[model samples]
Target: MKHLSRLNKYFLKYKWWIIPGSIFVVISNIFGVVPAQVIGYAVDLITENVHVYNLFSGFNRQEIVYDIFSSNLLYFGLLVVLLYILRGLFLFFMRQTIILMSRHIEFDMKNDIYQHYQKLSLGFYRRNNTGDLMNRATEDVNRVRMYVGPAIMYTINTFVLSVLIIWSMFDVNSKLAIYCLLPLPFLVIIIYYVNTLIFKKSGKIQERLSDLSSFVQERFSGIRIIKSYVREDYTRNMFEIQSNEYKKDSMSLVKVSALFYPTMLLLIGLSTILTIYIGGMQVINGNITAGNIAEFIIYITQLTFPVTMLGWVTSLVQRAAASQKRINEFLDIPPDIQSKSNDETEINGHIRFENVSFTYPDTGIQALKNVSFEIKSGEFVAIIGKTGSGKSTMANLMMRMYDVEQGQITVDGQPIKALNLKNYRGQIGFVPQEVFLFSDTIKNNIAFGLDQVTDDEVFDAAKNASVYHNIIDFDEKFETMLGERGITLSGGQKQRVSIARALIKSPKILIFDDCLSAVDTKTEEDILQNLGKIMQGRITILIAHRISTIKNADKILVLDDGKIIEQGTHNELLSLNGAYTDLYNNQLLEEETKGI
Candidate 1:
């Protein structure tokens, strides 16, 4: 109930719909009970006419009977039909209002969840898996919608119908009504006991579903590796096991859900027997007429459907609460990374890391330690390091993917956190080592950084990244849409397209994190030369493993195990008998040995 309170705002938002829907529910239920009363009245009218005719009528009685009963019966039957037709109309309006409101709420909720997903920092994604997140958004949301729409609708119908029918029954004879409704308190007891089990099982079933979804997603995403390793049978068996687990949990929930109908029928059956047996006695004792017995029977019949719905509605509320709790778990978490400043900071092409240090929140592995560097405008600064030596971490910090734990990063002498986070990121174009591209056309991939771009600008960026020729040779050229993550392109082509994406932005600060690793030497050199021409007024930081790539850089920083070992020009680093000198010689020998 507490978790579901989060949806109250949405209810308030769509209050107009609910108000009319409630009115329709009351009016419809009113018409609903009136027809039952008509049925009872007709039964009495026919019974009294037959009794009077048998006692005092003669041979011409058939004609008299037809004249007296015909008009009266016809009028009652027509009136009953009209009442039902009116009820049906209001029912339609009720659904249109309440169910439609639920759909609108579903739309808004999905948007809110997805919007929050985008705002969350990288660490949040690390803490949660994709499949669970997807399940909460899709399956859990759908369950909640059931509660809002059909469950809510039926609940109101049941309450209104039950109250009117029970009141009418007691109005005729309080003792008989007690006998007819004696089984109801037991219904409440059954609901309370079953609710706990249903709620628990519902949560477990959803968790298993999330697990199965995650397993399938990973298997498909890594299908290539699975085939390459010839592990098809192993993967198949693994999936079978997970699928069976999901089936087991689902069956448990199904079994609990199946219990509702039988139990409901038994209680309703008991109530019917009690109504008939006690009302028969009342008629015999002359306390009430046979007509009243018929009315009591009709009232019980009227209450049957709503009473049956009690179990169904209870299960729905429980499941909805479970799902709502899961959804609230994510919604409650405020994104840790937010911009404090309202205005975008002006770019001055100067960046400084003043004793900055950071540790990965997911693993707590310190990736940088008291690192400090400064980049002036128009400088081609390169960072060289072995794997896991914090070169890429520097780029991540500069991009503010994770805030520094100690010290500060300043852009144009202003603390980076003080700048508007979105605008600050917008000014830098970063190409990570692991390139990812959307399934989109070649032109759109290159121009992805900008909201609007000219064809010539896209072409120019592609040319600079040395992927223009590759794209043009394709059948659809720039209009060719790639597969998921741009799997249609070769490794080098994908990397180049990624670089082109960054270059298209023409940003004030550019960071390339060894994004050219897959390209051939000639293409790499061509791309570098193109970058040199564009580097006139930008701060370019290149993270590289290849010594040749950074040999001509204006400044080079050597990193070893999360700390900078040396910083100087490429020639100046060679002059020192240090780690940088040894790495350069080793790389140079490898190139020579390969006949490069």
Candidate 2:
């Protein structure tokens, strides 16, 4: 219910529909009672020996009674039909309105969540699972939609109809009405307890469902690894365990729900029996008329429906509340990064790091410490390091993936933090180690960001990356679909396509984060040579492990444990005979043995 309160703002926007929907429901309930009243009157007339015909005869007692019965019965039947039709019409429109509103709200919620994810630091994604976020955006939103639609309307229907029936009963005979209501308080108590239990259990069920979805998603995404290691049987067993847990939780919920209808029936049965017993005695003792007793019985039967509906609506509301809580939890997490300025500034590609240091948010272990460097405009620099060194962190810092805690990083002598994020990001192009390509034509992937990139521009960039010939070899050429994440392409081809994407941006500063790892040495050399020719006046930062990749750079750095251990030209570092020199010697000897 508290979760539902948050929906008040959205509900307010659609109140124009909701208000009329409620009015129609009230009218339907009011007309719904008429048939019962008509039945009571007819029964009383028959018991009093009234004629079924001759209602048009002049001024006779029996004729008057017949007229009353005939006219009232006709009107009551017509009212019933009319209200039922109105109820259906209004309910259809109401559902449409509410569902439309829910969809809009869901859209807004998902967009906000996605936008928040974009603003968050990389560390946030490292700590969360992709499947859980997808579940929240998809399944949780659908649950909210159900609540706003049927759950809301049915709840209103139950309350309004129950009140109308009860008040009608009292109008007929207060004593009989009280006896009929004897079971109500207990029914309310049971519903209250059931709602509480449903909320707690449904929350657990949703969590297990999320875990199951995550398990399945993770396994499917890594199916290649599973097959490579011949772990299919093990993966199947793990999936079975997760599925069984989800099944057990769902069955428990079913068990709880199964009890609700029967308990409602029991209470309804008891209330009806008591109404007959007491009202029949009152009629026989002349304390009330036969019509009153008949009306009381009709009202008693009507009471059961709303009571049963109460249970149904209560269960739905509890499930919706549980879902709302999960959704709100995701929405409540503050982004780890926030853009502070919106003033756009032009970039000149001069980068400086002054005594900078940083640690990953969760681990608290320093990834980079007191590292400082400067790269002037148009310089080609390479960072070389062994695994576990701070090479990648330096590249990430340049892209502002995670901001440094100590000191400042400036581009063109202006602190990056002071510049607008969108403007700053536009000046740099990055090609990461992992290549991700959407399932689209090659041309679209290359021209993803630019509004109007000509085919010639795309082909020229691809030619520079040495992938244009391969693209033209395909049956569909540039229009060929790449399949999921470019699965159709070889690793080197995928890397080349990613490289072409970055090149198409024509950014002032280009970053290749171990981008050449997959390509052959010859292909890598050619691409580097072409890049060097075309990017003479642009800053280029290359992160690599191979000596061949960094040998031609103007300056090279050897990093270890978040600090620069050595920095110089390739020949100068080899002369030092340190970590870099040792690595170069091993690689040179290995290549010689292979007769390269």
Clashing pairs in 2: none
Question: lDDT per residue, candidate 1, 369-430, as tens digits?
Answer: 99888888888999999999999889988888878889999888888888888898898899
Instruction: Rate residue 37 of model 1 by lDDT.
Output: 75
Model 2: what TM-score? 0.92
Top model by lDDT, which number? Answer: 1
- Clash numbers, per candidate: 0, 0
lDDT of each: 0.89, 0.83
